[model samples]
Target chain A: MNLLSIVLYPLISSLLIRMWGGKNPKLAGWLGCVSIVLSFVVTVKVGLHFFINSSLEPISHNLLTWAILPSHAILFSLKMDVLSFVMSLLITGVGLLIHIYSLGYMKKKEYGRYFSYLNLFIALMLLLVLSDQLLMMFIGWEGVGFCSFLLIGFHFESHKNMNAAKKAFVVNRIGDLGIFLAMMIILAVLVQEKQLWSLAFEDIRTHLDLFLTKSIFGMSLATVLCLLLFIGVCGKSAQLPLYIWLPDAMAGPTPVSALIHAASMVTAGIYLMCRLSFLFDVSHFASEVVMWVGIITALFGSTVAIFQRDIKKVLAFSTVSQLGYMTLACGVGAYAVAMFHVVVHGAFKALLFLCAGAVIKASQGNQDVYQMGGLYKDLPWTHAMFWVGALSLSGFFPFAGFFSKDLILSHVHEHHLFVFVLAMIGVLLTSFYIFRLLYLVFYSGKKRDLPGYITPWVMKAPMIVLAFLAIALGFLWTPSFLGSIDLFPQWMSSLYMIPFSTHSLWFEIGLSLLALLFSAVGLIAARKLFVHGPIADQWIKEKFPKLYQLLLHQYYIEEFYYKTFVHDGPPSNRKLSQDTAFTNSLFHFISVIKGMFDRYVIDGLVHWFAWIPQFLGSIYARIQDGQIQTYIRWITMASLIVLFYWFLWVSGMIA
Target chain B: MNQLFCLESYLVISSFLFVIGLIIVLTKNNAIQIIIGIELIFNAAALNFVAFSYFRPHVTEGMQLSGQIFAIFVIVIAAADACAALAIILSLFRVFKTTRIQNINRLRG
Candidate 1:
């Protein structure tokens, strides 16, 4: 409920990692889950009050003031509303499920550390959503980003996973730079207009217009700040060029993938977009850019997903595409639609990942679709549950995805038909390819071998629960829960200001049928081609060579980075040699220049300056010397210089 | 806000202390000298805060709060940092029986 408990949940989790008490993995997992469940309960209670009544009774006071400047106080601020509360639910509730699933998923090796890292991640995510000030949120933001790096590289003994985690951290760091820049820019604008600096979201929003009117080094600083902040979003949410790290992030534990990619970290970008939806509304060009980026990411992600061999990798790319949909909602000025997409996508994406985790276990870690065929007979329950998830993902009618995805497509249509057409194609590609994935892995009709480990209760329980949410969330929009929130008397009672009901029952039913049609058509096409043999696969390659290869290589975004950045960065694998050689040569050349100056130029100048001092010194040395002859010679020179000076003065040569 | 800036002006002593710490950090060859430099910087910050409190009488918490918090941050960081430095010193002692930075090139080729 407060900052202590908010941070304590994860801190306690980290302690459990070492509290292995002789290394019982089950005990460690239970301890981690217990702590997470408690945090979830507390946050849920706080969230219930927030949603029912849109008031958090913010506790306000400066935790500590600047030593020399009291006005520059660092206040401990905490409050709750629909948005943070919902995020709290996702962070804690979905977090609890992932924690439980990890018990089974991470049964191998040092699971104590894995659970500990996962718990820390959950805690930091809570802090990010719950904190009141931008500075506090930044701490939580960076904290979670760090935890993501930790969890993603939990198998750091392996080089590829470790590098993937590093890449993720570095990419997010670049985005975070944008966040820092935006904060600095915001501070500058606020100070210039009001003669004060504030990081409180409410206070900054109050000075929004004044900030827009100000200039920064001849640039419209508001646009700069917004774009910079979007860069941060782009990194986390995996939009366009910045999304290369996510599919590789699948190298971590599947639960980690579900938690980070599906449920929490990736959505942070969308949350940020929605949080600053008010600022974005003021910039038409920026919003349009957000829209276009979303479309490209959606199409790009879905196309790549179609060709991915690894089960989790396909779902990984799917998340990037889905997040693009949420971002698309933000771009089209339908922030609520974006938020809605986040909820639906979180539920179904997490379900799909967990289900994929189960199937991978069932198939004895053979996640490649080419290795999997007709697993439906062995794991019927998993198959059915996986169907619910895959259908929901494909936007089948009467499921969660249909309501959210169609709302986005309809909103885009209202704005512009071209955007709508892009979203429609995105919808079609998503439906076709997700079904393609489902058919390839599960429904190909050829008998496949399955492992016995999938029968474990630990594995199937969370899948069942997620499957229900995936099925039932669509019904929440049917007018019952809308009236329940007394304090927040709006439909869907979310933090964002948008319509709860955007379309009629007719549109909802019609879209559901159409999605079913698309899914069925895709399923049939895949079954007709791939259910029997390798012919369909060969045909696909032969028919669509360039497109298939492009999709297979993720559009060569990695290749671009490889050519321009990494390979060139340490050229020809000659780093140490080049570094030592360059440093020695440059320093040597400088010394040679210094040597010439010391011998010729500097020595000549010093000798000239020293002449006067020497003449005076020789006369002074005549007063006291090591030898009498040397002293007499110095006296003779001094007398000669004095006579010359007197002659010049008397003869008027001084003029 | 007015008192805040006045306090900043009086806080030059803390800035001077920090500068001295920086010089010691740079010029000292001994690890302990660098440690001492860090402490000097911390003291400078503490003194700066106390000065601000004196300047801004109406702002009661100005100096005391920051001085105490900064002292804690410094103390905590210093403890951890000192442990790391001491470990390096111990390893160096084992290798060379001396704490000279010039001779601690076993880490280099």
Candidate 2:
């Protein structure tokens, strides 16, 4: 029941609030929070049960089955396993916090609409995590994308927000196409060749040999599926080429930035890859692409993060970078580690964003970090919460980010050295930029006499809770030297086919120490550069003008995309015009026929029918002169005519 | 009634009355005259119905008197209709200020 409600209750709340809560914004907001809280409680209950009963098998709750063929069936179901349990707990728990935060974050205009979208997002996110079948998961997946589109464009009054939402949706659709195509190919293969059709994860995993044997244009079908699925991952997780939308998604409200962009929805791609770990494990080429994509995106996101001016954009890029780390863990076959990072990162990233919200709120809607400085004393609680969140994000010791990141790093190091080196670069840049954002926003420069905007308790409560989580949640799985509890990874071992290989305590400790040192270095460097104002900023901008400009402008990838696709491909390609002309003329011909049919055939028939009624009405209307004498004369004439006809018939003069 | 007066006499009188009423209705310019002409035609039809009921053999099954009942219903309906027609004429006079039928052509389509 609890498991069912985890997906059901929020959907119910969304509908109810949409129906009845529009008149009362406070009631709507509270209703949104209450629904998520209920789901959160259910998730916690289910998660605890799952943890306590370690030997328990994955429980599949089949809701309905649509039988398409005698041999095939598609089941709409929800599965409760160690993996979904962890993800659900994160989604609901952090989702509730974000909902509470949104109460304070949203403005007074159409806030019920905002709460509706928020609740809808939670429901979809839960559905995505708890879904049993791949098809069902895709439904949840597309649903989350749709809700994100709605929430990101919540302030649809602004063109910028609407465009950002459009970009995010369009990019995700491209990713979804990959999932769709992969599903199609898999289904086609299962139905046509293997003669066994099901999309349940168990069925797919069991039929690996059949999938491996099948070849698509000379490449193994499994490899193609994995690669295509990775393409989907790239889009959702904000990896290379598709990472453009996440930064601009900051045009939405801040709590939305925290929940969908940073914490839960963006990690869906990583979750998908982890869910399909067995398939990915079999495809070496696909794994390599995933690794490289993760590394490049991590580097790209962080480098861009370093140059970002807007407070939310900085966090947005940092989120893109952090998602890259989780994706990297998946690529390196550390599925459990990737999931662990997903959970820990969900806590801290949400904390960071909520604190940023407080800052944005206190600063009177100013989002530029440079315009905001010395806010530490003005917003003491927010400052402290931001500190915890930032430290955790930077992989500072004892915070949640440190443990999971350390685990990922150790695994990466054991598997590949060059990949590990690139990952290290990404880590350093992540730390430097986040601390730089912190230093610029909170600690550095002269303090402005900001208006006395009190941070609401609704906002502060979530930050406090997330801050606590950021500080202590890492203890769930500490390294061996730190007493080696390792509860989270151990708990997740059952979900993945290949368990994480345990490393020596010395190696783990060494990696943890190194991560701590790098974090400290990044923090100290950020302090030196930003704390004293414009010296390093000016120096770097002048010294590496081209590099600075490239990073600042996100390497002109958006412009390149516009130039290539939006502006009719390249000028050098003359064939493009010919192709377009052919298609255009074809469409024009069809449209001409359609117009003719509409104007002459269809409309002519209607007009002809209308003319009949009009003609008859005119003749009848002439007799209805409304004169009593004329009406009486006509009645008498009609009576006489009838009498004459009757007389003739009586005399047998007419037949 | 048939012994006292031949059926032809009643038929002739009613036909003459109907013709006179028709001529009056066709020629009348006043709305009230047109209504009176219509009532004269209605009375002629009522008289014919009574004459037919008396002359015919089995129209009224002993005490049923269906034709007489029908004539009484028609008379009652004509009285109500006359009252309604007079009310309409009064309203028409209020709007147009004259009861001349030829002039009251406001409803001409």
Candidate 3:
């Protein structure tokens, strides 16, 4: 609620761990759980105050000022608006659930260090969402990335986890580059007009005309900059081309996958998109590009999720696909819809991953679908919770996923019909993969025999809470938030988007019906093949070999990255030797070529003119008269003339 | 005293000393001499600053601010720099002694 909580959370969490200092890690886990719970409660109170009085009272706390130069002051502060309120609420609310879930999921393990990383993650996610300025947000951004790197390699004893952590960090750096570039562009625009950096949100937006309305290189610079930045979003949000890291991110603990991959870290890009919506307004063409890219990635991601063998990987790819939907929502001039999807998806998707964690831990880390069958018999709570999450994810009616996902498709339909069709295809893929995952793992006719490991009531509590939120939050949308506000129509007047009476009629009758049909078909099809059919897995792997292989292998994009950037790259010194003899060899080569051109072509003409004078100077230097004889002769002649002049009128002549 | 003051000679002597210092910094194998050469450059700059300060007193903080600041900064930088160089030299001495840059080749593979 106050500034102290923000700073106090990590401190107390650490101190609590130290107080419970032990090699045995249960105490540390409890300390982490208590700290996050306290932090979440404070954040919730703060969020409620801000949410209720959003327009008039902008909630902000100047936590501390870290530095102040002559020209600028770096104020580390928390600022909450409608956007931050939503993000902070979800982060704390859902983040607390994940932390609680971690207690049970990591019960037996040494999670002291792990909990510290997780606590730091919670703290950083709060900073990221609550901060008013870009730099502070980036610190959170980089902070979360660092924590993710730590958590993903939580099993640091394993080399695979370490490698995957490196991969995640490196891939995230690509997006971080975009963030850095966007900041640079903002700075450059400011520099042109003698404006200060003034990274405060409103200050930057007020100077929007200085950057966005300009043109460069035969195109609007703003559009170019926005498009460049979306590349960053693509990386962070696990969009195509840079999504390879996310699937591998499953190397961490299940709660890490749930927190970072499903809910928090992946949502960062969408959060950034919503924050910088002003830039998107100027970049019309960039928005269209974002729309198409989102559509394609959504479809591709769902397609890949269908073939994933590992349970967490399926959920990981599902997060990717679901994030694509949010990106698509943002792309098509629907901010509220995108935020809705982010909230809804964060709940259900995080639930799905955590439930998957329960199942995995119960199955003793057995993640393969073929290995895990009929879990429903032994693990009823986890099974039912998993189904609720799966159905919500599949856009079943009355689920939060249904309300949010429909808007994305609806906006795509209104604005870009082709993207709409692609999104529809994406929805079909989403249904297929989700139901398939559910059917093979849980609902298969054959029961998965497992040890009678009854999860404590604490484990089921978060699952039930998240499941309720996932389903019931759809009704919370409730047509009331849509009442006073108008959703501006695509390329049309706001009058077109005013809350008309038929809005609910269409959602209830048409959209809801389509959703029902999709769920029924997906459920029946998955059940028919996976539940009854004996050779379902084999049929998929053998019959659809090429597509299955491509999906399973993630389209060989990792190989493509290796061939392009890694193998032939300026080999990293960590991977190779750090040669002190060589540095920026490529730059040196370019400089040498530039030097040759400058000498022989550019300066050659100047030297051509200089050659004659240079030759003359060389000859004059050789003929220097060092002797005094010639000097003496010249002086005597001058003296004789002076003497003659002196005879006439020496003083007068001198004057 | 006025007749004896040859500004050109002082300028020439300073120029010669500055060039020798530059050569030492660029080409010397001994780290200590390089540090001394850097000190020479500092003195050259200080001499120029003091000369200008003496010639023009009423100028608005131009030579006053920058001259005094540079003089202080140069001394502080020299001290800090000597400590750093000494650390590097000590470390290098542990690896390869003789205080010569050329022999600091353990860094090479």
Task: Give the best candidate by DockQ.
Answer: 2
After superposition, which runs of candidate 1 have C-alpha atoms over 4 Å from their true positions? A1-3, A19-24, A51-68, A216-219, A478-494, A497-520, A533-535, A568-655, B1-109
DockQ of 3: 0.01
Local lDDT at A251 for model 3: 98
Clashes of each: 1, 0, 0
The window of 10 residues in a row where model 3 chain A has the poorest summed lDDT is A488-497
Summarize candidate 3's per-residue lDDT along A268-339 as a digit string, tens digits: 888888887777766778888777778778887888887778888888888888888888887876766777
Per-candidate interface DockQ score: 0.01, 0.49, 0.01
Model 1 Cα lDDT, one tens digit per residue, A146-177:
88898788879988788889989988898899
Which lDDT tens digits does candidate 3 get at residues B10-107?
A: 56666777767766776677878878887787777666655555555487744456656766776788789888988888887777757886665453
Which is the winner by DockQ between candidate 2 and candidate 3? 2
Q: Which lDDT values do the candidates have, in the order given? A: 0.74, 0.85, 0.75
Give candidate 2's error at residue A42 in angstroms. 1.8
TM-score of every candidate's chain A: 0.82, 0.86, 0.82
Model 1 chain A poorest ten-residue lDDT run: A480-489
Q: Please tell me which model should have the higher DockQ, number 1 or number 2.
A: 2
- Candidate 2 scores an iRMS of 1.7
Compute each candidate's TM-score over C-alphas: 0.71, 0.75, 0.71
Docking class for model 2 is: medium
Which predicted model would earn the best TM-score? Answer: 2
- DockQ category of candidate 3: incorrect
